[model samples]
Target: MSWHLFVVFFASTFFISATPGPNMLLAFQYGLNYGVKRTLWTLAGLSLGLFILLLSTLLGLDVISRQSPWLLTVIKTIGALYLIYLGISSWRDTNNSSLMSDASAMSAEVSAELTPNPDRSAKPLPRSLSSAAVKSVPNDWILFRTGMWVSLSNPKAILFFAAFFPKFINFSAPLWPQYIMLTVGLFLSETIWQLIYTIGGKKLAGWLDVGERLAWLNRGCGVIFILIAAALIVDVISTL
Candidate 1:
């Protein structure tokens, strides 16, 4: 691809990745609760999922979906149900002790501040309890599967990649290299952004002490996800 085409493609992909979506939000939650390292794994799984989606679409899976109405319907139902289940879990887990584990860390910091002679020169603070909670959750195979399921189950994401990936290609030349660059760029940029959010959220652990604020944030994201799932389900039913 020419530099101009590459730049435009990169810019567009970056912008799309930067938009706060379910994956990014999940990354943030993972980062805030787990820690950068584990979240990195989640991010890896997520990137892999995206790449698989791209490859599948490129391999004419979209054509199959178009030709098989029932298949698409099945995907839509599964995707919507999965999203709703995730949303409800998040909402219910708002008060999960794991989420509140950072409370002790914050208390320790406050206690140290109150002491007359706290150590002036200590090593950099370790990750917060919130991050520890994330780490404590057994990510194992389930996280990988969840990432893959969420990415591949959504027909909308497939439609998105199908519509978007081709626009960056130059039909005049061989397409493989362009595909490689686009897929790599998309995956890297998206992964990096999620990492940034995950790491950034870890730094905001102090704010976790404010239970009200944290609850509000959780509820907000949870509600948005629920609404998105509802809309997707409605669309599915209407299509049926």
Candidate 2:
């Protein structure tokens, strides 16, 4: 692609990425709860999801998506339902967790101390409510998977990339080199932007009162997620 086209694409993508979508929101949410360092895993998962979307688009999923609108709607509905479930769960967790056992309390205490990493056997986690099964925050891999799921679940992302990426393509030229260049640039820039949001969230966490838990933030993110889910539903309905 020409420099002018690259600039336009980069700027557009950067700004669009800056917008608080599910992926960004998840990064922000996790950043607050898990800190910037751990959030890197989540961001990595999001980037992988984006890479898959771009690759799928390049491989002509865009054509299929365009041909089958219902597929997109179904994907969107499924994504929305997932987010709605998360929102409700997050909200309820924030409230109910107020009375939760001490095991669930802490920044990353319970999760780190009790729950073994997925690589480990499940023999450790207590059945009822010991330090282990206290509704603790997830570990790194779980957060990463959460990011992947959130990104991949959003059908809007597939459609958006499908529609948006083609505009800057130089069909007359060799595709592979351009693909490599654009994907690398796009991925790196997006990663940087996501890091900023994650770091910003971490900084915000620093400002919270020492005693303040992540419950309020969880509740807030839950509401935002529900709104996003609602918006997706509204969009789907509008299409019909």
Query: What's each prediction's TM-score?
Result: 0.54, 0.55
Total clashing residue pairs per candidate? 4, 0
Residue 100 error, candidate 2, Å: 23
76 Cα displacement, candidate 2 (Å): 21
Q: Give the TM-score of candidate 1.
A: 0.54
List, residue by residue over 1-240, the lDDT tens digit for candidate 2. 888868766765664455445666666655655557777888888888888887876666334345775776676676677767767876776433221222123323424543456444222322432443324445677767766766687776666554445445555477667777678767867787688667875454344323435566566656755765777777668779
Which parts of model 2 have CA positions greater than 4 angstroms off?
61-135, 202-240
What's the CA error at residue 236 for candidate 2, in Å?
27
